[model samples]
Target chain A: MNTLDARGYSCPEPVIMTKKALEKGLPLTVMVDGVTPLNNITRFAQNKGYKVESRAVGEDYELTISK
Target chain B: MKNKQTLLIAATGLVVGALAVLLTLNGNPANMGFCIACFLRDTAGALGLHKAAVVQYARPEIIGLVLGAFIMSVAGKEFAAKGGSSPMTRFVLGFFVMVGALMFLGCPLRMVLRIAGGDLNAVVGLIGFVCGILGGIFFLKNGFTLKRTYTLSRLEGTWMPILSLGVLALLLLAPSLLAFSESGPGSMHAPVMMAQAAGLIVGALAYKTRLCMVGGIRDAVLFGDFYLLYGFVAIIIAALIGNLAIGSFNLGFDGQPVAFNDGLWNFLGMALTGLGSALLGGCPLRQLILAGSGNSDSAVTVMGMIVGSAFCHNFGLASSADGPTSAGKIAVIIGFAVVIVIGLANMRKEKV
Candidate 1:
């Protein structure tokens, strides 16, 4: 499992990072600090046909995306 | 619960729209209240950053907006000092956004208001704006990004708010220090305190609701999310009702107050604005709110806008009611070129 810390990034940035990380193969864990990024990454990952599981990790969100 | 939240967002839009109309009725230019680009240009003129005599004023609404967002963010525990995410790039994007906005004589927010006031020229602008956003969405799907931001000291985040307060102080205590328009759009204004109050109220609501016209349309195209778009639609409806009630609705393209009937320039101008704002991750109003909440990158963006406003007037690149100047048209073309280059340059190389 590869974890990408996207905790402080804003929109489109997080989604882009997720796209880049997904290129290296999954299951991938993405961490974000806000709802906007969480929702954005979830949307991006789901749109790409990946299964995404998201949960709160102490005021931040962790999303696990897998094929 | 989601329905309630959506309704509250709509209510916020209504209040904002009604305030805009009230501001217009109370002395602000007809159909010309709360234009972020115009206000920044006026503020630039007031500061002597540009010699545009007819548009000089230290607009209190701008100050109120920043301070309102600052107070709300602090109270909500949402304020965080952050920056260092390609500040110069954001600055350039901000500058071009202002360029496009001045060319069109409004921002996306004002574009909506113009449509509500029955300016068909704005309808043409809207079509251009949506086209630009769709273009941005293409880049977004291809992994366009401006990189990530870093956390900074609290003092770094407070600079914009402090600057806002300093401007407010100057506007109140030392009015003689800044230039005031003798006549024209700058000379016409709502009472300072009333306009400030209106800005404060709208700023607070907008910050809370994350009301951003660029984000509204971008999200709609990117994620099928209409959450943000609903706010803008509500604004149009509310402002439409207010305009009709006040007999301010002219319902035509020609002779609309403070707007030109030139459809092509209006479209291209807003197209540039939409593309720039989409690349910057927010619109001018959103940049202001983000700056208030301690985003130094956004503060730099706002500064870029001020400078851009000055540049537009100083170099004769801004349009007037007579319509877009030749220089302004060329600048808009250059703006599109620069923004497109930026969009292409920022795409992840691997993805491209």
Candidate 2:
């Protein structure tokens, strides 16, 4: 399992970063703000067959992916 | 695999569109609802690019769509900076697309919104668009070719994003340059930052997903690809939900905002745009994204849209809420003929 942080990033940035990390072909964790980035990242993850879970942590969202 | 991709693309478009509609409900405007064409038209006016006083404003959706595309491209490692195709031809096609869009006073996206809003006129315009697209498909099948492009330096394709950033700077630092309507359709707007932010994000996402209405239809019709088309459907559904949420659902054609009562011209105008987009290989939104990715051809098309707006307004070829100008009707006819001639003429004598 691998973890990537994107908490302070804006929409698409977090998603894009998460995607970049996923290119390593390992289960990963992504953090993002707002509903949009979450949707984008989660969809990307789900499509790739990575198991995913999300929870609101204070001001932002934390999403963890596993395969 | 294709179904999943289709669902993702369409769902993303729907979510983005719904968010855009939410912006409108919070004081944006009606049936304007969510349109890249109308918004770009307003942005042009805000820059005093045209004197159509009733329809100018700095549209956030346009800004958001591009920036959104940029962000995704950069993040996903897919933002390959590249450009150079038949720039002048692309520009002319873009201009004609805008001309046609103004005739209808809406692009493909708006056509969808119109249908969602229950405007029967849009149904006619959509049929025209399909006919035009079919025509373009014919050209495509017959080896009508725009030359293959060579990838350009990254900085070359970064011009649109830089320009967008400049617009944002102007919006925030020099507000006076943006024309605001004292009354009428131009006066209505969501907040400047909000509009820009939304546009930027949507643009970036669209760039990454390659969510193009023109490509969606073309691919579906020509190649049997449905990924992009799904995004097109998503936008309508999201817009409907957003309209419902904001109590802006009108459900009929009697009185749509920023749209005219002319039906035939609307059909012709959208038909022109549809054909132009098909020939050019992307919608206006796709053009912007391509420009962001360093495609000079797309940049040229965008330039055409800017110039076409000027021509549409100056020559009285643009429609108003009341209806299409007589000049606009003539322009639509001439515009269509001109595009047909150019498209056929541009075909290479030898297959590339």
Candidate 3:
């Protein structure tokens, strides 16, 4: 399992980073501070044959993606 | 389920409009909230690139927008620097786009903003913008392309962002280092903190959605894709709602602030904007975002805008409410010719 912390960053980037992590064929936990990125990363993963589960951790979100 | 994406995008549009209205209510000019071209021109004037007294301010919103976008790009691990995609051509297109935008006194964002605030003058500019986009679509159909940009070192992408941060710092710590207008639009601004927050939100959301108003219209025209247009439409709806709530909605052509009454040039001005921006492959806002994200080609285009603004101001090529200066009208004609030539020259023909 890998942790991808993308807190305080905006979209496209977090999603872009999440895409890279998913491409590594590993289960990953992604932290995103922005609502836009949280939804975007989850959508990108779900669309790419991965299951995504996200939970709020304080003001940020933690998203889990696994094949 | 089907409208999920549309709803999501429209939400971002709503945020954009909300902030824009908030800024206007907080002392930003009426019908002049968040114009990339105007802000860029004002920035250039602030730097003494052109001695335009009435429009000189190192707008923190512009700095914050680029800086915010750049920060996001880096945080997302997507800040790759690249360029050489007909950079000079892009610069020229950016230049003319600025020329056209200033002549009419706004960008596509401002055009929509104006309409949202009930200025009918923008209605004409909107028509011109559509037509200009149609012209670009014609060239696109004809195989006109500015080519592609290749990846460069990551450090290369840091320059513009660094520059923006530097500007932000200077504006904050050393106020006298940069010029600020004592009157006119340059002098008008929302509180610095509010402006920066608005710009940051907009920059970040735009990055996430890949929102491009011109792209939305172009996609709708080219491929019947209304996905993006939904977001564009949402901005207007949200803006109108915001303006009404703030008691800023005017509802007419007469007495619109920072807007010209001339219909034809308004049409032609935005026609030039639409065509040039279409040819350059993005609106002024998109260009700023792209530059922030480390695309040097876009950086070049941004520079072109700055230079274009200076040239327009120095050469008497910008229009005002009284109407376009004769020089501005002449520039628009020349601008059309330059853009058409660029279009024809770049277009490649497929062999049957």
Candidate 4:
């Protein structure tokens, strides 16, 4: 499982990073610092047919994407 | 609870729209109150960045907007110094967005106001604007991004707000240092204190509500989210009623104040504005609000807009009531090409 830290980033950046990382294969965990990114990444990953499990990590969110 | 929040946001829009009308009635340009692009152009002219004498005036509203957002964000504990994601790119995009806006003689907010005043040409511009947003959404769906931003020291984020204060001081204490338009659109303005108060109220509300015309349409198209769109709709309704009551609602393409009847240029201009704004992650007004809240990237974007405003007026690329200049048309085309190239270059490479 590869972890991608997308904290401290704004919208579309986190989603784009997630898309780029997904090209290599799934079971990836992405860390984001805001709700906008969390919802956006979840939507993007789900649209790509990936299962996304998101959980709160204190003030941030951890989203795990797997096929 | 959500309904209350929605009602509050709608009320905010109504207040903004009504204030725009009031500002216009008090001497701001007709159907031209609260235009970020036009006001910025005037600010650039006042600073002597451009020799467009008719448009020179250091608008107090802009200064007030920055300070208002700064104060609001600080009070809300939402002010954090952060930036460093493709500053130059945002600068260029901001420049092009100004070009497109000046070509159309307004920003999206003004476009809405124009429609509320029954300017049919703005309807044409609106069509183009939506088309441009759709084009941007295509790129966004394919993973367009400006990359990551990093948090910076608090001092770094205070520069824009400080600059705003400095400008305000100059406007109030040293009026001789800035140019004032003797005639034309620049000369027409509400009283200084009134304009400043209007900007402060609108800016604080916008900051609280996250009101953005570009975000409104983009979210609606991309996510089926109408939360942002509702604010704009409220603005339209509120402004429409105000314009009608004030007898300012003139329905025609000709003889509209501070506007031209060139439909093609109007469409292309706003199209460029919409696409550039969509790619930049915010519109001109949003950029200002963000800069107020300590985003240096948005500050840089605002600087780009000022320079672009100067460039438009200096080179005669900005339109006038007479119509769009040939040079203005060419510049808009170049702006599109440059923005497209930037958008293409920044996207993540697809797997081979």
lDDT (Cα, 0-100) at B85 in candidate 3: 76
Residues B47-125, candidate 4: write the lDDT tens digits. Answer: 8999998999988888878888899999987787889989999999999999999999999999999999999999999
- Candidate 1 lDDT tens digits, B253-341: 89988889899999999999999888888889989988888889999999999999999999999999999999999999999999999
- Give the proportion of true interface contacts each model preserves, from 0 to 1: 0.38, 0.00, 0.00, 0.31
Lowest lDDT 10-residue stretch of candidate 4 chain B: B343-352
Order the candidates by DockQ, highest first — what do you get?
Answer: 1, 4, 3, 2
Worst 10 residues of 3 chain A by lDDT: A8-17
Q: Write the per-residue lDDT of candidate 3 for residues B1-352, one digit (tens) a residue.
A: 3267778778888888888888899888897778998999988988889888988988878887788788777788667677777889889999999999998899999998999999999999999999999998888776666764566787777777888888788888998978899998889999988898888888877766667778778767764556567778888998999999989999888789898799999999999999998887778988888889888888899999999999999999988667789999999999999999999998767510
Q: What is the lDDT of residue B33 in candidate 4?
A: 72
lDDT of 2 by residue, A3-60 (tens): 7876533222354457667777666777664444576577667766778889988646
Candidate 4: tens digits of C-alpha lDDT, residues A1-67: 7879998776655766777788776689999975557876876676667889999997678999998
Q: Is candidate 2 or candidate 4 better by TM-score?
A: 4
B1-352: candidate 2 lDDT, tens digit per residue:
4466566687678867776676666567666655767777777888888887887777766766666777776776556554455778888898899999988978887787777666778888888898888888777665465555555688877787788778778777888868877777678877766666667767766775777778777766764545577888888888777677767777666687677667788778889999998888878878877676556677778888988987888789888778888898888788889888877886757432
Whole-model lDDT for model 3 versus the true structure?
0.82
lDDT of each: 0.87, 0.74, 0.82, 0.88
Q: How far off is each candidate at the interface, as Cα RMSD in Å?
A: 3.6, 14.3, 11.5, 4.7
Pick by DockQ: which candidate is best? 1
Instruction: Give candidate 2 regions above 4 Å deviation.
Output: A1-67, B1-3, B348-352
Total backbone collisions for each predicted model = 0, 26, 1, 0
Clashing pairs in 1: none
